[model samples]
Target: MQGGTTIVLPEHRGHRLGLALKVAHHQALLARFPDVEWIATATADVNAHMNAVNDRLGIRVVERCIELTRPVGRAS
Candidate 1:
């Protein structure tokens, strides 16, 4: 499972480039690796745009991960 990164230039957003790129990338990778059974990618939960695209592609939420952050000078 590898390679499904989609990035749209800021100036090129609003044209569905991200969705198109992801679908195309997935198709190409699958074609080149027919033996693969699972492919994985991660995105922040709040990113509705990408999440929606992922959902449309039959990807599902299998796990939830939380990242904790603190300022350098702040005590935990």
Candidate 2:
């Protein structure tokens, strides 16, 4: 499992390395573990660039998960 931060790097702008790496890693994992059924990843819904690459790679948005947090013991 891996998670990435923002995509505001000037050196990486206009390059698809992030997408390429993600795809390559996914393929490698699949090849290394043929028995595995699925490989998963996540990115912000607003990240259209990542979404486009994911679409190209045939990744579908299966479920939407949201994180809810509250102060420990501070009930609503």
Candidate 3:
């Protein structure tokens, strides 16, 4: 299963809510799907807190993806 964006309000930071949320979701996923063996999630490289949460949950980085964008214009 792949996780989507998870956020805790700025006023609610530093309470380990992110970690708790991930843990709860993982437990629920396993409970609902005993045959499932893997879960995937991604966070921006700058997001240290989320990275820490994933690390604590034993989620290792297996791949890296980079996004690139360019403005479109009339062809010359």
Please give the distance, in angstroms, between residue 18's alpha carbon in candidate 2 and its true position after superposition.
Answer: 1.6
What lDDT tens digits, residue by residue, belong to model 2 across residues 1-76? 4545535366776688767777777777778778877657787799888888788888899999997887766575
Model 3 lDDT on a 0 to 1 scale: 0.87
For residue 58, what is the lDDT in candidate 3?
92
Tens-digit lDDT track for model 3 on 1-76? 5666878899999899988888888888899899997888888888999999989999999999998877778742
In candidate 2, list every pair of residues with a backbone clash: none
* Model 1: how far residue 21 lies from native, Å: 0.4
The residue ranges of model 1 lying beyond 4 angstroms of the native Cα positions read 69-76
Q: Which candidate is the best by TM-score?
A: 3
For model 2, the stretches where C-alpha displacement exceeds 4 angstroms are: 1-8, 70-76
* Clash pairs detected, candidate 3: none
Q: If the candidates were sorted by their lDDT against the true structure, best first, what order would they fall in?
A: 3, 1, 2
Model 1, range 1-76, lDDT digits (tens) per residue? 5554577888998787888898888788889988878877899999988898889888998989999888676654
Candidates' C-alpha lDDT: 0.83, 0.74, 0.87
Better of 2 and 3 by TM-score: 3
List clash counts for every candidate, in order.
Answer: 0, 0, 0
Kindly indicate the candidate among 2 and 3 with the higher lDDT: 3
